[model samples]
Target: MNDTTWTTPDLTGHRVLVPGGTGAVGEGVVRAFLEAGAEVIVPTRSEERSAEFRTMLGHAADEHLHLVVHDYTSFAGAQDLVEQIVHFRGGLDSVVAPIGGWWQGSTLAEITEQDWHSAFTVLGTTHMAVLRAALPYLTDAGAYTVIVGDSSAWPVPGSGLVSMEQAALLMMQRVAAAETGSSRRVFSLVLGPVTTRHAEGFVEAKDVGTVTVAISAGPVPSASIGLHDHGEVQTALSLLTAGEAR
Candidate 1:
């Protein structure tokens, strides 16, 4: 890993959608994309949440950030959101979905129906809904990236549902990549404990955003990349930056 940070790619005039941009990790992703000069649209169900996010972003939210107060948890709502974006922005160039949640509960065998529905079903469905709704409209050369946790590969005892749901999302990205072939790019970013604005960890949220923006800028060798720590994040960014230079 290098000691320096990767430079943000120039994404002026590009239109990108980030569905869960109100969350901590998503905030970094949103900021990085906006800094890269992309017209980033973030959807939220609450206007108050939108206001809060804008405040969090400060002046960065002024020009290119589009905060839409809309619910994108369901298929119909996701489709509508995409339609509205296309109609307004003329077209969408890319998408970065960092949508997820944590759930701590009993073992899988002892988990309740409500817990399963909330942790596994709802989170997984939201990702699928956004993918299905946005895939058709995504530019042929554009990218669709999914952000998941390392729990997908490593079992978390109390958060078994988070692990299961994250694994499912990883598989979904693989399938989508295979189905799309060379028409479009699909990437899965598997992260470990991330350092967000609220917590400390090996991988920082800004680094996550940087790698994600790099992926959107150009093609990568593989669809799945692991960002477990600072070293891994730097390696990925270096590889991506090198690819862009070519």
Candidate 2:
């Protein structure tokens, strides 16, 4: 996994959208795409947050970067938000939903209805809402999507809401592939822990287990920064960027 280089495809002014672009993995996606030369549009809940994210981006590449006031929690706000993003980019090419959920403290016996809903909102509702909002531009661009998900979502015991939601996302991914029929594409990168921020991102043991498999299956890039497996996350970004070209 060390000899081969997982080159991040050059975006060169390409318009790529990343939802939840201020969260843990979202920030990593933003930085990685920007480094690869895409005109990345990060949509979030507030303009203030947008500015803060811009500041987080560090250097200004005025010609190749932007932030949008896109809130996805509301069905009513979806259309207008996409309209605004489409207006900002002129055309859209890619989207990365590095958004998800995680909670380990509670066992099934201790889980509450609220816990279930909290996980659902992150893993299910958020994905549905954002995808619904962007489907227009996404279809227009030959729809490309990446679902960041937990490994435990696959038949793991006591997973509760997260598994159900991840399964739904997986079904959507497969159904989208069939429905797209070469017009568009989507994939679920059952994500693993990525070290960028202290908290990094939420990925289960199963996710990490898959990373070992991918590495064993082929060359793995050195993307982990500390205990955080940035390599896994960066590899996912590399795949999404490459999908645009294909």
Candidate 3:
């Protein structure tokens, strides 16, 4: 990948909630929003994880990053979290759900019930919980972006469960966008192997963040976007930026 630096738009006064802000790809999303001057709120299940995320972002993020220790995996917990955030932040402007996990080791036919539940049910429910809780409260112009892997569109051997869940999320985003009409925006950001802090791949995590920030900001070209590699990322950014300018 080329050493290209892209600019993040100014997002002053915007309030954004990132449910999976502690993960590898989520880290990029959180930092992008924080750097863009948004009031970024991250929900973590434990205090230790919250502290680690804060440290990962460093001292500069303290003023804008609000790390809340809360379990948003359950429907009730997600509702409560949304209420708390809206009450405190005045209103929510955006949500970026980069929440999910990689599953392997068993073929679809060979997988146990527990494997299926762990790999699909838990993660899918969490995404749904957050969507149900926050969708109603989102501002009219607000955006809801779901980040999933390219597996959503393709099958992976021994990881069929992950693909199933990811595909479900993609459909969820589509349904949300259609149901909401033009009143609100919903986007599915499909990514390939993301190059994060711990791994190497085609697209950088920061680029993922940049694209997400662009989507959150406005003028997205479509309800579904794919960022499989550096070229796709740049194309997405250009499209978003162009739309914003027009």
Candidate 4:
């Protein structure tokens, strides 16, 4: 590697917890953290799938990068994940919560109770749980990030529920950021629609495969960004770990 200031991320010794970290983009974030010499913990409910994720990481799946099987659906589950991280390698330095689900195109009139609950669980509730769990560990030195979508920033024709949750999350993050201010850095990963298989429950099953690509590439006017896209993740890592160098 070149001796450039930006080549290596700033997370030299931080411990990062990535909720729903095994998915495509989330995995990319995990890998980026690992590359930055940070200890990466992936927590999810899937057991065998967690191991499979390790295998999928090729050769970088070492002791520093680990996976934990835990439910992220409630407050208690989030606490359990935090405890597991503490048991393994101390406390959390930062958290990357990316529980993206229930993201299909549905008009406000068509949204149902079930849909609302699902979106809340994936978008709002997950962030709530993770933040509550991380409260004890996060301080003036650490930060947390909630992965969000560009729809949160702008309007979409048939994404009322999504827009609602997205807007709520942005507000929550901003509030936390304001409260934390220079003490802690609460950030948001705002991106446009992504083209990947991670949209299993979010998209209309049949329309997902085809339309997702179209949405990513065509005149949807949405920008598709990834965790390992080289810009955002690196900067995030730097911000989270700058204390290490100091």
Checking candidate 1 for backbone clashes, the offending pairs are none
Model 2's alpha-carbon lDDT is: 0.57
| Ranking 1 against 2 by lDDT, winner | 1
Cα lDDT of model 4 by residue, 95-208, tens digit: 776666547757878878888787654668778888878856763434576777777767677767887887788787777766655556566656554444464322222121
Per-model TM against the reference = 0.95, 0.71, 0.94, 0.74
Clashing pairs in 3: none
On the 0 to 100 scale, the lDDT of residue 31 in model 3 is: 83
List the RMSD of every prediction in angstroms.
2.1, 7.1, 2.1, 9.2
The order of the candidates by TM-score, greatest first, is 1, 3, 4, 2
Selected candidate, larger TM-score, 2 vs 3: 3
- Where model 1 places Cα greater than 4 Å from the true spot, the runs are 1-5, 244-246
Count steric clashes of candidate 4.
Answer: 0
Q: TM-score winner between 3 and 4, please give it.
A: 3
Candidate 3 regions off by >4 Å? 1-6, 244-246
Better of 2 and 4 by lDDT: 4
lDDT of each: 0.87, 0.57, 0.87, 0.61
- What TM-score does candidate 1 reach? 0.95
